[model samples]
Target: MGSILVVMENGTGGFVDSSKELIAKAKDIAKALGMSSVAIGFGSEAEKNLKGLSVDRVIAVSNPELTQYHPEAYEKALAQVLQKDQPFLTLVANTTMGMDLGAGLAARASLPLIAYCSQLSVEGQEVLATSSVFAGKLMAEIVVPESGAVISVMPGQWPQDTDRGDPPIDRMSLDLPSSMKILQLIEPEKGDVDITKAEILVSVGRGIDNPDNLPLAEELAEAIGGVLSCSRPVVDAGWLPKSRQVGKSGQTVKPKVYMAFGISGAPEHQQGMKDADLIIAVNTDENASMMDIAHYGSTVDMLDLMPALTERLRGE
Candidate 1:
């Protein structure tokens, strides 16, 4: 039986959450296909982290040149692993590093590549993956025609794997070319507030109309003792900093209460804040995607609603 291979990612202290989520999905696919799940990671620290994963085996590829993430170096290392094992399915996170390496690895291995996969299933003998299209207005189901297919799974679509057991670790090495090197790692500016830990989030989107009206949302958030957050458009428009942005490309937040004002609820934005305990959305369009996931929704104009809501919350 062909094995399911998962490419693990390295984070500050351990593997990233997306990597574990892919492993969880890979385990499910492997079970249905009657195959074993194998995980390949880089670095000795990654080997220590992989010991807790539930995969059948963990291959840790270590090299001096791989101390940091270099796109070409990763592509070369992954290509060597894929060439040797030739697994039925290869899974990577649809993250910055994953997207960088996924296409190159697929082309190098001569396999089909699927990206932004939110769901995967085995239909008959073929593996089918579902991904969002058209700004998440539609979902497209893609079928991998043959084995050795590579897929980049989107984060937050599946629950993270919690099974903690020591998996057998296999050590390996790679000779990376000196031509590939990271010049520098420039980190983004740290925001004054960390929205990820906010108990309540009052977020805005394009529906707010203008950046000049941001104070209205800020007033409401302050009244409710909540942090001010926003969708990608708000950040893109420069009304809010990227730290305030909540979405797949921004921050994944799980606040106790998420109050969205004038947000259209695109899948990318929803993936970040969908796990909130209480979702309350206020949009003029009652049929907005935000309303679909909201526990309580109001079809009122946010321009009029924000001031009144702020006053009411302040009065209480």
Candidate 2:
């Protein structure tokens, strides 16, 4: 039986969404490969938050140097742990920190590394990874040509298993790299709607046609108390900021409510928001591909319906 180590970054707020998604996928890999799964993370107080997972073991390395991310220090301490554990495979989330540390870890450990992988599977004494190429236009399959493999998984690519039983804890203290220390932390200015946290999102698409029509979609989002997102085309045309774009080339969202306005539902656009719990597409074209998966839709053009709905909401 093989042993795989799952390295998670438990930061200030808590364990990131991507970490949980990785653990879920790790559990599947562990089961399929007949391997034991051990979860490791670093934080000032990270143990309590991760005690509820179904992992075989949870290791918390507590230190102030790890309070904020310092890539070299993380690599050193994590390398020590990995060398000691000698796990057959290691997995981590493909985030900013992951990107920073992935190459260094692979070099230090002399293992094959794969980053931003969309999926993972075990073959005969080999692990296969899938990733996108050509700006998401093509998918490439990667195989790790080593006995020990390091993989960094993309966010929202794996489904999280919230039903896993409580995970056991194994607390430990590791030597901190003296060179690492947190200096200052700066937070970004949050928007009116934190699109990342929004459970319900109503995204505007290419069909809106003009920037002047954005307010109408904003009104609809306001009515539903949801975040307003856009497809790549809208952002490319400067109708919306790049931060608001939702697609394969943009942000990946899994909101509870996904309302597509005039979106033609291209494969690229659908790739971003396919995980939405409930999808409602409103477009004049009744036969657009977006309508195929839409739970509720109207054949009327959004231009004609939006003003009337806004006025009705305002009691006009």
Candidate 3:
């Protein structure tokens, strides 16, 4: 069996949480397959981040052209590393950069590509990867028969392994083409609150009905000393900003307690807050998808329950 290759990404401070999740998963897959795991880093900063991860080896691809992220440059550099290493399974985080890089590398190498994988395992000799489809309504398992396959693992699916010590880093020089140049990197506007750091989140969904009903959720959040967050629909409806949205496309939060109101529990939304210590979901429908992962489920009307729950918490 060939080695498992994890393509890591660096963020503002160091490695992104998704990259750490990939590294942990990659280590598990490598151990299961009786193969070593190797992490591929782009630059010096990435190398520094990769060192702290628990992997067999870290390959740092350094080049002046690799400073800023360019899709073509990343593809070319990763293609060279892949050709040389030829790992059995290449993993990348299912992030913005990972999505672009994974697709480009898969296309460039003509390898099988799997995206948004939440679960992975080895059944006999076949590599099975499970991902959600139809907006988290159905789960699809992909089987890769080829030796070299590229998989983009979703963020927040696997927990980060922080117990491991620093691994040895090997520097590789790559001759990148000067065709594509990044002119400027524009950052998104910052939101009022960073929901990712919130210890408690009172999240609402489309079931809230009207924008006027938002104050009820806010009152509940405040009553419990928690922050008010929402699903994607709430943000789309202009009831909440994008910063307060929790899902795969939004913020990934691992709060101590997550209370869901009127949320159907789509897979995209579940991926974000599923790791919370305590998940309590209240919806009209008992058979809703949100109930599937909730620690405690309530089949009560959220509109009626919110006020009462808030009042009870406030001892009013």
lDDT of each: 0.86, 0.77, 0.84
Tens digit of per-residue lDDT, candidate 1, span 231-288: 9998898989998889877888999999999998887798799999999999998878
Ranking by lDDT: 1, 3, 2
- The numbered model that scores best in TM-score is 1
What stretches of model 3 exceed 4 Å from their correct place?
47-57, 64-68, 157-180, 183-190, 314-316
Runs in model 1 lying further than 4 Å from the true structure:
64-67, 164-170
| Candidate 3 per-residue lDDT over residues 210-306, each given as its tens digit | 9999999999999999999999999998889898989877888999999999998887788789889999999988878888899999988899999
Model 2 clashing residue pairs (backbone): none
Q: What is the TM-score of candidate 1?
A: 0.89
RMSD of each: 2.4, 5.8, 3.1
lDDT of 1: 0.86
How does model 3 score by TM-score? 0.83
